[model samples]
Target: MAGAADAATTLVGRVLAGRSGALANRLDLAGIRTKPQDFAFLIGVLAVAVLAATLLLGAGWLSVIAAAASPVVAMLFLNIRIARRRDAFATQLDGTLQLLASSLRAGYSTMQALGSVAQQSEEPSASELARIVNEARIGRPVVAALEEAADRMASEDFHWTAQAIAINREVGGSLAETLDGVAHTIRERGQIRRQVKTLSSEGRLSAVILMALPFGVAGFLMIINPAYLAPLFASGLGIAMLAGGAVLMVVGGIWLYKTVEIKF
Candidate 1:
């Protein structure tokens, strides 16, 4: 049981490590540690496979193959969702900092600017800054409040600003000017990223279609041909090949993804 718990911990630890903002960090603030959802995710993965095979067992060989592959599909979808959300949150980081800088220039104190941002910014950022302001109003130190805010949002861009604020309070410098520079830099970087994404959209789409076409056809074949696809899963060698093929497809997709994703 300890080993199982350890494994689960490791899985969630990886996810949490990959995350920093409102979703994961709030758990720490609320005295909550790791989430049961981590273990649930593992179970969900296994369950997807089991349920698919069971449901399609007597269908066609192609049907069983499709069912067996459902787990991989489900996990891929889950991963895409997580990645998209993380990307969106990261994309918003620069804007959030720009908003903070603008508010500061408008005569708002840091805390007040954050509070106003909480009231106006979109979800996740709004949800997070509101927490920071609330925590400060309850008497948390300004630095701690700001740290908590950074730790919660956890974007590279946002964290840089947070570090500036936290470090500035101790050593002191022109914080607003520093933040203004940072915001401008972020805006420029974001524009370049947007252009890269636009330029790479065709390649990304090709990758998606290339990856999905085979599986989609296999599913359609299973609906039409049962005997033809049966031997592939009934034998161990076939199962290995099936798994290998699936892995190859994933690897290819990842390669295409990286090819198109221009990192700045």
Candidate 2:
């Protein structure tokens, strides 16, 4: 049984890692404290709950469909968490950059400034910087550490700043001035991002409401008129229709989300 469990974990890990290790990278970027095993366990539990719910409803095909979708749902939740954390980190980034520049101007080394950021800032930047500082402490190259963090955060501007620092270290330049400029750019971009978000708020909200409408109506009907939608759950064709409608709804949601999401 232990061997079987271990094999299951290995298989799940490989499946999650995928061809590009994108899931692993996302998990890292999200700064989820749980291990992969824990994540897999939680997903399994949710899958089992879904399976149980469908079974209780006497909807075999629906049960299978729900079971199949369980992992996707879990991944979506993880992605949401990662997004929220990254948003928070982005909010903190300008201040972090400014602090690092100030430290440099105050005669601190790059590592010293990073260490201060690690110690002083709030998460997820503090945690990210602390990881970088820890890596450097273990004799890894600081630039490499910064680059790795940038990649993990999926921050292009941060990556550019990292590259600038790397070049400065190799060619000799005013590090403080470079960092100050980067900080200014980051702040300006953040301001623009806020403006865009504000301008698009109505569309974003409408998208969310539209996405939730079907589910909300279904839930309401379940309470007020289960008999009305009973056929939709009773027949095999109904199950298939439900599955297809779910797929279409997911696709539409993605399309709407992409339409509203403005990147600067």
Candidate 3:
């Protein structure tokens, strides 16, 4: 039995290995330290639990749907975590640039200034800068390291900062001043982003409430009178209607999201 179980685990690991590399990169970006295989196992367990619960509720179709949706839900959660981490890194960019500029003005070389920031700054920022410093120490060009970091974080401000550094290296300019200018621009953009988020808050809230209403109503009905929602899960026509409603709701949610998301 032990050998069989070990063989099953190895089979599962092999099956997941191809996808695990990408998942591991995303988890790293999200600051999650779990091994990809472990994370995959946890998600599989959650999916199985959801499938079992739905089956226990006596809805075969619902169990199938739950099983199918579970992995998607896990991916969505991972994406949200990565996005939040990226946003946090972006939020810290201005301060990080300012500190780098200060370190430079104090006579540190570019790499040394970055190391200083890595030591002095807080979370995400410190770790990211530390990674760049480590890369530079290993003979990777500082500009390339910066560019890679920008790409990883998807931060335009950091990309511009990297550009400025690259240009400064090729030309003759005060690197400190260039960083200070980039910091100022990032600060202004941050302010604008916050204002936009504030203005769109109401619309975002409305979208959430709108998207959740049907599910909320269905759940309430289930609690008050389980039989009321029985036909929806039991009959083919009702199931088709439910699927259609779900697709439409997803489309409407995406439309609402696009409408409120302002690109500047």
Q: Considering every candidate listed, which one attains the maximal TM-score?
A: 3
Worst 10 residues of 3 by lDDT: 4-13
Q: Kindly list the per-residue Cα lDDT of model 3 for residues 1-264, writing each as its tens digit.
A: 778655655666788877878988988988899877767767777888999998998777669888888889988998998898888898888888989999999999999999999999987889889999999999999999999999889999899999999999999789999989888888888899899999999999999999899889999999999999889778899889988998999899999999988897
For candidate 1, give the lDDT of residue 168.
76
Model 1 lDDT on a 0 to 1 scale: 0.71
User: lDDT by residue for model 1 over 86-202, one digit each (tens)?
Assistant: 566677777777788788888998898888878888866677678778888999876677665555444567667777887777887666788878888878878887888899899
Residue 102 C-alpha lDDT in model 1: 81
The segments of candidate 2 whose C-alpha lies over 4 angstroms from its true place after superposition are: 1-24, 53-68
lDDT of 2 by residue, 164-191 (tens): 8999999998898888888888888878
TM-score of every model? 0.65, 0.82, 0.91
lDDT (Cα atoms) of all candidates against the true structure: 0.71, 0.85, 0.88
Question: What RMSD, rounded to one decimal, does every model reach?
Answer: 7.1, 3.3, 2.2
User: Which candidate leads in lDDT?
Assistant: 3
* Candidate 3 residue pairs that clash: none
Q: Native-vs-model 3 lDDT?
A: 0.88
lDDT at 236, model 3: 92
Please identify model 1 stretches exceeding 4 Å from their true place.
1-82, 135-154, 170-174
